[model samples]
Structure formats: structure tokens, C-alpha cells
Target: MRLSLKVWRQSNKEAAGGFEDYKLDNVSPDMSFLEMFDVLNEQLIEEGKEPVAFDHDCREGICGMCSMYINGRPHGPLRGVTTCQLHMRSFKDGDTIVVEPWRAQAFPVIKDLVVDRDAFDRVISAGGFISVNTGNAQDANSLPVPKEAADDAFAAAACIGCGACVAACKNASAMLFVSAKISQLALLPQGQAERSIRAEKMVAQMDAEGFGACTNTGACSAECPKEISLENIARMNREYIGAKFSSSAV
Candidate 1:
């Protein structure tokens, strides 16, 4: 199939950026979205032109690095799938696709289709961990976790930190990503020690990172490749409130 692509091109974070169009031929329906880009890049390179730059790793979709806002949706129009997992069959022959990077102050573009997501790492560093050493691995039966909590924790842990939540939000909020991180731990007994402080510090750091405020719009969850639930955001709010109250009571 042949297709037209309007992709964002930026030399650097400070450089002015705009959409550049290109036509691609011989695209296979089975080719993943990134593979299509690879074909385009190869064609440009063969012509001695600078290839379009995009982020991708572990093309199997585990890395969450294939971040392309395609046709105004993060990771294309698919549900519960990342850009690396999106296939060209989702489009039609002679179609025009618009692709852009994640748009958020905290995720400034470093180059074409690549944004600096280190802000997420900083937020995680602020409190997303359990510092308490529980020693070596214990028998699974030794600490029997409630089945419901274990399931919920596992679901929350599926978050790949793709920044789709931030990209999908009207306010560019990272609340969904931050909440999933908090919930994955807060629901597990292993994360109990840092519960209150985790919520406090992470939320503070999220704010400091210039991420926008969440207005309870469900766009983030709807677009999240993991489909991380809005309930995690609610849980995070409760955790933050409880932490603040506990600190003030001291």
C-alpha cells in the first residue's frame, strides 16, 4: 500500500518544529508502525537526506519507547496497544496519517518524535520505591496477600510509563501514570513502609515537574496502552490526603 505521512520535524528542543510530509510505497499491512517508519528512514538515507528520527526499543511493545501521536491519538487508534504494536493494516491504501510527539511541557521534544521523559524518572525517584530491606526472597505462602489486592497490584504494575496518559490529557496531566506507580506498591504489603511518604513526595515531584493538573477527565485512562484504570487516580488522591493529614497531626 502507498500512504502519506505528515510527521513533526524538530532539530532540537529549542528549534522551531513543523510537519513534514512524505509518501511511502510498498508498505505491508503486517508491518508494525515502527517498521513503516524504518522503511521511510531507509528511503531517505538512500537519497542522502536526513532520516526521520523516532524513539523505539524492544519493538515487541514492552519498552514503551515507540511514542508517536498518530492521527491525534497516542499510539494510533488502537486500544490497549503501544505504537510499536500498532500495525499498518489499521490504515488504508492512499491514506494520510499525521504523527507528532507527546505534547507536554514536561516532555519537551529532543528531536523529531523523541521527547525527554526523564521527568518521569525524577518523579519516581522522589518516592516511588520501598527503601526498607526485607531481606532475601521469602516463601510465597509465608505472607499470603489477599487475592484481590494481588490482582489489583499486578494490573497497576502493568503500566509501562509510556507517557500516553500525559499526551492524551487535555491538561497534559501525569496523574494516571503517577497513580499507577503508587497503586502498584500501595496495594502490596511489600510497599507498606513507604506508603504515606511515597504519595507525598511523588505528588510533590509531579507538580514540580511542570505536569498539568488532573481534572478527572478520563482521557488518560482511555488512551493508556495498559488501560490503567481511573480508580488508581482515586486511590492516589486518598493516599495523598491521608499522608497530608498524618503529617499535620504529628
Candidate 2:
């Protein structure tokens, strides 16, 4: 259960960074990837060395904060699994693992294995919402949307903005994330009011954030934890084109 870890070490965004090797002994195959990191950090602290800096808000994988590039794959080698949920058993004994942060210009390195993802916040702030003045509460079944649309909306809404989409893309595109958000609204009755405007504003903001364009590589959906489909990207394109042609967001 022992292995060598080659982890990225960077003091700050401007600082030069490189991989530092460490030997992890007495490791348990049952341990989660983040738990293995905790063991490593404890050992480093005992030796009066600064522990590797990584993000993990909820180690249970619900918060999407446990973002990392494990052995060149976002959230480790497993499909549809976040780093916090990745189990050490996935790797063989005596394996050499390379860990790093999400590599993208928009997602700058905040420290070792931690990148600033506030660009996602900026995109969300750019009209990823509805504006109708519906005075709050309504009947439970008042506006029954079609079941298929509801399912599609729910599927698209599952995106957690982990940026695995960007990390997996050759050009580091955020289209999957953006398109997921756009499709979530475009497929639902509640989101209809702001659909067109939302698509336009979010797309503009995504470009402003310096994210690369989608080239149909399909890597983003493959790496996505929620398995956000590429169909959402197509839906977003349709929404954006339709919005540009319309005078109003109707």
C-alpha cells in the first residue's frame, strides 16, 4: 500500500513551481485520496515542513472543492469521481502518482494544488438567473412542466463547476460548464423568462473570462463528474443564436 507521490509545489501564483517527490509508506488501500493527502500533511507538519496546499471543503465530494489533477487526470483516474471520492485502491502498490492543480489560464494557481476559480463566479454573476417579478410562492402543481424537460433541466443542473471540463479540454474550454447552466434554464418553464438573455450574457462573460472556445473534442463531458452531456452545448448554441436574432429575450 506504499507509493511515491510527485506533487506540485508553488508558494504563490507568481512563484515558480515544480513537482516535489515524497515517499508515502504504510498507506491503506481503503483510504480516500484526500485522506492519503492528510496522512502526508501530518508527516510534513511533524517535520516542521509546510504541508502541500490543496482544496477540500467537503471531503465527501458534495462541494466540488476537492479539485486536483491526479496522475494527469482531473479527480484522479476514475470516471465520474471527484478527488475526494477517489479511493487509493484504484492505484497499485508501489505506483508513482503525480498530482497537480487544474492547469488553465483562467484558473490561476493560488498555491500548490489550489487554483483560483472565481472566474466561474464571474460567469455566474453575468446573468445566470431569472428576472421575472413573480411574487414568490405558488401552488405546488401550478406550472407543471413536461417531464422530459424537467429531467433534462435536472441533468444539466447537476454541474458543480469543478472545472474538470477545462482541465480535460486540450484548449481548456469551459463550454460544458457554461452550456450546462444554459441548458438547465432553457429546458424548464421557470427558467424560460430569462433563457435568451441568460444565454447571451453568460456566453459573453465566459469569453471575457478568457476561456478557450469549444472545438468539439468532447473531453469536457468525459471528465465531468456529473456527466454533463455535450448535447447541452448544442442547446446553448441554439439559445445564443436565437437570442441574438430576437429584440427581446422572449
Candidate 3:
């Protein structure tokens, strides 16, 4: 396949950025999107041009680092798949693909298609973990949890924090991502000790990071590669309200 790519390029965060067009030929439909990029980079290197810089690690889709907006969709036109999993066959020959980074105030462009996602890390650090010791792995397992709760927690835990939710939202909201982290622990017995504080802190940090408010447009869940449910957001709102009430009563 022969294709034209319009890729966003920036030397650094403060630098002006724009699209640079390139023509890629002899492409294989079987090659993964990142693999095609590798080919493009090789071609650029041969011509002594600066290869595009994009974030990618463990191209198996496990890391969620291969973030890109292909055409107009996050992670390309596919549903429930990351850019690393996207293949050339998704597009036809002679296609003009536009690639850009996540557009949000909190996610400043680093270089090329890569954006600084440290805001997410800060939100996680605010309270995304279980600090309460459950004694040991065996002891933690002894706590009985309902089948439904376990399943829900597992689903919420599948969130890879790729920021697709923010990129997809018109307001650049991160409620879905924050809620998924909250629900993952809120549904489990092990996460009970700090449940109230966890919800409050994570949400507070998300707000502090300059992420926009959710308007229930469902764009976040729709664009999420993990397919994280919108129900998690509702649950988080409940958790936050409950935390506020509990704190007020004390």
C-alpha cells in the first residue's frame, strides 16, 4: 500500500508545531501501525531527516504508551484497541492519514506526537493505591467478596490510563479515568479502609491538573481503548458525595 501521512511535529513543548506530510510506499497491510512508523523512521534516517518522536513501549498494547490520534479518532478508527494494535489494513492504499497528539491543556505536547502525561501520574499519586496493609496476600484473599463486585472491580482495574478519554472529550474531562481508578478499589474489600479519602483525593488532584468537568457526553468511555464503562463515573460521584457527608458529620 502507498499512503500519505500528515504528522504533527514539535521540537519541544514551547515550540510552534504543525503538520509535515510524507509519502510512504511499499507498505504491508499486515504491519502494525507502529511497525509502519518504524518503516517510515527508517526511510527518514536513510535520507538524513529527523524521524518523528512518539511514545511507545511494549507495542503489545499492554503499556498504553502508544498514544496517537489517527485521522480524527483516538488510537485510530478502531473501537476497544490502542494505536499499537491498529494495523495498516484498517485503511486503504493511497490514504491520507492525519496523526496528532492528545489535545488538552493538561497534556502538553512534548515533541512530535508525544505528550507529557505526568498529570495522570500526579493524580494517581494523590490516591490511586491501597495503602492499608491487608496483613499478607493469603490474609487478603481470606476476605470474602461477592462475585459481582469482584467482576466489576476487575473490569474497572483494566483501565490503562492512556488519556484517550481526555482526548475524546470536548471539554477534555478526565472523570472516566479518575472514576475507573476509584471504582477499581471501591468495589473491593481490600480497598475499603481508605475508600472515602481515595475518592476525594484523586478527584481533587484531577481537578488541580486542569482537566475539564464531565458533561456525561460518554465520549470518554467510547474512546477508551479498555472500554471502561460510564457507570464507573456515576459510582465515583456517589463515592465523592458519601465521602463529603462522612467527613462533614465528623
Candidate 4:
């Protein structure tokens, strides 16, 4: 397959950036999107031109580090797949692909296709954890969690913090990602001790980081590679409201 890529390029976070076009020929349909970029980079290097910079850790799609907005969609046109998991075959021969980084104030572009997603890490640090004592591991049967709760918790925990939720939102909201993190713990018994505080702190931090409010547009879940549900957002809203009420009642 042959492709024309119009990719964003910037030298640094403060540097002005714009699209630079490149033509690629003889691309394999089986090649992952990152692999195609690798080929492009190699060609640029041989020509003494600077290579495109993109974020990618595990090509297997587990890391959520391959953050490219392909043709105006997060992670290309595929559903339930990350950028690294996107195949060149998803495009047609002679296609013109436009690639850019996540476009949210919270995720400022560092370079070509790499954005500083440390805002996510900061949100996680605010309160995305359980308070468990350090000791030998407890028996799995000790708590005896309800099957429904357990299932939901596990599903919510599948979120990989990819920031697609933010990229996909018209408001650039992090609600889906934040909700997934909150629900994963809020649904589990191990997370009870910090339940009341988790939602408040994380949501507060999310706001502090300049992430926009959830508009209920559902774009976040639609573009999420993990298929994290919108129900998580509802759960988070309940958790936050309940926490506020509980605190005020005291």
C-alpha cells in the first residue's frame, strides 16, 4: 500500500507546530501503524531529515502509549483497539492519513505525535489506590465479593489510561478515564476505606489539570480502546455526590 501522511511536527512543548507531508510507498498491509511510522522514519534518516517523533512503548497495545490521532479519530478507525494495534490494511492504497497528538489542554504536545500525558499520572497519584496493610497476602476467599460487583470492578480495571477518552470528547473531558479509575476501586471491598475521599480528590485533581467537564456526549467511551463503559461515569457521579453529602451531614 502507498500512503501520504500529513503529520504534526514541533520541536518542543512551546514551539509552534504544523503538518508536514510525506509519501510512503511499498507499505505492507500487515504492518502495524507504528511499524509504518518506523519505515517512514528510516527513510527520513537516510535522507538526512529529522524523523517523526511518536509515542509507543509496547506495540502489543497494552501500554496505551501509542497516542496518535489518526484521520481525526483516536487510534484510527478501528473500535476497541489502540494505535499500535491499528494495521495499515485499515487504510486504502494511496490514502492520505492525517496524524496528530491528543488535543487537550491537559495533554500538551511534546513533539510530532507525543504528548505529555503525565497529567494522567498526577490524577492517579491524587487518589486512585486502596489502603491495604503491608503483610502476607490475604486469602482470595476471605472477602467473598458479590459476583456482580467483582465483574464490574474487573471490567473497570481494564482501563489502560490511554487518554482517548479526552481526545475523543468535544470538551476534551477526562470523565471516562477518571470514572474508570474511580469505579474499579469503588466497586471493590478493598477500596472501601478510601471510597469517600477517592472520588473527590481525583475529580478535583482532574479539574485542576484543566480537563473539561463531561458533557454526556458519549464520545469518550466510543473511542476508548478498552471499551470502558459510560456507566462508570454514572457511578463516579453518584460516588462524588454521596461523598459530598456524607461530608456535609457530619
Candidate 5:
């Protein structure tokens, strides 16, 4: 397939950025999106031009590092898939594809299509883990988790921190990502000890990181590669309110 790419180019976070155009020919339909970029890079290198820079690792989609905005959508037009998992066949021949990095204050561009997502790490660090001593691995049957709760927790835990939620939201909210992390731990028995403070701290950290408030437009979940439910956001709000009330009562 032949294609035209309009990709964002930035030297660093403080550098002014804009789109640069390139044309690619003889692209294979079976090639992963990154592979197509690789081909483009090869051509650029052979022509003595600087190659496009994009983040990618574990191209099978597990890493969530391939965080590109393709044609105005996070990870292209596909559902439940990351940019690394997106295939060239998803596009038509002679199509013009617009690619950009995650456009959020919290995710400032480093260069080209790469953005600094360390803000997510900071949010998780605030209160996304269970500090209690649960000891070594116990028998699965020893603590029988309710089927529904376990399923829901696992679903929430599937979030890959890709920042698509931020990119998808006009407000650049990290609520969906933060909520998923909170929900995953809050739904499990092991996470109960920290539950009260977890929601408050993480939400506070998210705000400190400059992420915007949830728009209530549901764009985050719709573009989420993991399909993390919007319900997690509601759960997080309840947890936060409950935590605040309990703290004030003391």
C-alpha cells in the first residue's frame, strides 16, 4: 500500500513542534504499524534524512509503549488494541495518516512521537499498591475470592498505563487510568488495609501531576485499549468521598 504520513516532530519538551509529511510506497498489509514506520525510517536513513522517532517495545502489544495518536485516535481506529498491535491493513492504499504524540500537559513530548509518561509512575507511587504483609503465596483455595469481584479486579488490573485515556479526553484527564488502578486494588481483600488512604493519595497525586478532571464524556473508556470500564471512575469517586468522610469523622 502507498501512504502519506503527517507526523508530529519535536526536538524536546520545550521545543516548538509541528507536522512533517512523508510518502511511503510498497508497504505490506501484514506489517504492524511500527514495522511500517521502520520501513519509513529505512528510506529516510538511505536518503540521509532524519528518521521519525516513536516509542515501541514488545510489539505484541503487552508493553503499551507504542503510544501514538493515529488519525486523531489513540492507537488508530481499532478497539482493545495498542499502536504496536495495529496493522497496516487497517488503512487503505493512498490514505493520508496523521500521527501525533499524546497531547496532554502531563505527557509533554520528548521528541517526535515520544512523550514523558513518568507522571503515571508518580501517580501509582502515591498509593497504588498493598503494603500489608500478606506473606508468601498461599493456596488459591485458602482465600476464596468471590468470582465476580475477582473478575472485576482482574479486569481493572489489565490497564497498561498507555496514556490513551489522557489523549482521548479533551480535558486530558487521567481519571480512567487512576481509577482502574484504584479499583484493581480496592476490589481485592489484600488491598483493604490501604483502601481508605489509597484513593485519596492517588487522586491527589493525579491532580498534582497536572492531569485534568474527567469530562464525563466517556471518551477515555471508548478509546481505552484494555476496555477498562467507566464504572471504575465511579468506584474511585465513592472511595475518595468515603475516605474523606471517615477521616473528618475521626
Candidate 6:
């Protein structure tokens, strides 16, 4: 198949970037999107042109590094899949594709399709974990969580922190991502000790990171590759409100 790619290119953080058009012919439908990019890079190298820069690693789709807004969607037109997992077959021959990096005030453009997602790391660092005592892993039956609770927590944990939610939001809010992180811990007994404090600190950090507030537009969950439920956002809210006037300080 043949396609025209309008890919953004930038030399560095200080460099002004713009879209550069490239034509690719004889593209294999079976090749993953990243594979197609690899071929394009090879062709550019042969012509002494700097290849387009995109973040990708563990092309197996486990890593969230392959972040891009493809053809106006977070990960192309596919649902529940990342860019590296999208195949050329999704598009027809002679198609024109516009590829751009994740857009968000919290995510600074590092290069072409690469954005600095360190804001997510800072959010997690704020209060994503509990202070468990040093010991071997607990036995499965030790906590004995209910089936529904366990399932909900696992579902929330499915979040890969891909920033798809951010890119999909008009406000570029990290609410979905932060909600998933909060809900996963809140549903477990092991997390009870720090639940309120976790919500308070994480929410505070999210604001400090410059991410806009969520407007309940529902775009985040719709574009989420993991399909993280919006219920988690509600759960985080419940936790946050409870923390506001706690009997004692966190």
C-alpha cells in the first residue's frame, strides 16, 4: 500500500517543529505501525535525512512509550490498542495520515512524537503506594478480599499510564489516569491505611503539575486503550472528599 505521512519533527526542546511530508510505498499491511516507521527511518537514513523521532520500546504493547495522536485519535482508529500495535492494514492505499505527539501542558514535547511524561511519575510519587512493613509477600488467603473488589482493583490496575486519557481530553486532564491509580489501591484492604492521604496528595500533585481539571466530558475513557472505567474517577472523588475533614491529619 502507499500512504502519505505528515509527521511532526523537532530537533530539540528549544527547536521549532513542523510537519514534514513523506511518501511511503509498498507498505505491508501486516507490519505494525512502528515497523512501518522503522522502514521509513531506514529510507531516510539512506538519503542522509534525519529520521522522524518517536518513542517506542517493547513493541509488544506492554510499554506505554509508543504515545502518539494518529489521524486525530490517541492510537489511530483502533480501540483498546496502542500505536505500536496498530497495523498498516487499518488504512487503505493512498491514505494521508497526520501524526502528532501527545498534547498537554503537563507533557512537554521532548522531540517529534515524544513528550515528557514525567508529570505522571510525579503524581505517582506524591502518594501512589502504602507504607507496608518489611516482610515476605503475604499469603493469598491472608487478606481474603471479596471477589468483586479484587476484580475491580485488577481492572483499575490495568492502566498502563499511556497518557491516552490526557491526549483525548479537551482540558488535557490527568483525572482518568490519577483516578485509576487511586482506585486500584483504594479497593484493597492493604490500602486502607493510606487511602485518604493517598487521594489528597495525589490530587494535589496533579493540580501542581498544571493538568487542567476534568469537565466530565467522558472523552478520556472513550479514548483510553485500557478502557479504564470512569467509575474509578468517582471512587477517587469519594476518597478525596472524605479526606477533606478527616478526624485526624493524614
Best by lDDT: 1
lDDT of 4 by residue, 1-250 (tens): 9899999999999999999999998899999999999999999999999999999998898888888999999999999999999999899999999999999999999888899999999999999998778999889889879999999999999999999999999999999999999999999888988998989999999999999999899999999999999999999999999998895434
The top-ranked prediction according to TM-score is 4
Report the C-alpha lDDT of model 3 over 15-133, residue by residue, as the tens digit. 99999999999999999999999999999999999999999998888788989999998999999999999999999999999999999999999999999999999999999999754
Candidate 5 total steric clashes: 0
Q: Candidate 2: which pairs clash?
A: none
Preferred candidate (lDDT higher): 4 or 6: 4
Please list the C-alpha lDDT of all candidates, in the order they appear.
Answer: 0.94, 0.90, 0.94, 0.93, 0.93, 0.92
RMSD of model 5, in Å? 1.5
Candidate with the larger TM-score of 1 and 5: 1
Assess candidate 1 and give its lDDT: 0.94
User: What value does the lDDT take at residue 245 in candidate 2?
Assistant: 95
Model 1 lDDT-worst window of ten: 241-250
Output the worst ten-in-a-row residue range by lDDT, candidate 4. Answer: 241-250
Question: What pairs collide in candidate 5?
Answer: none
TM-score of 1: 0.97
Off by over 4 Å in 5: 132-135, 248-250
Off by over 4 Å in 6: none
lDDT of 5: 0.93
- Candidate 2 or 1, higher lDDT: 1
lDDT of 6: 0.92
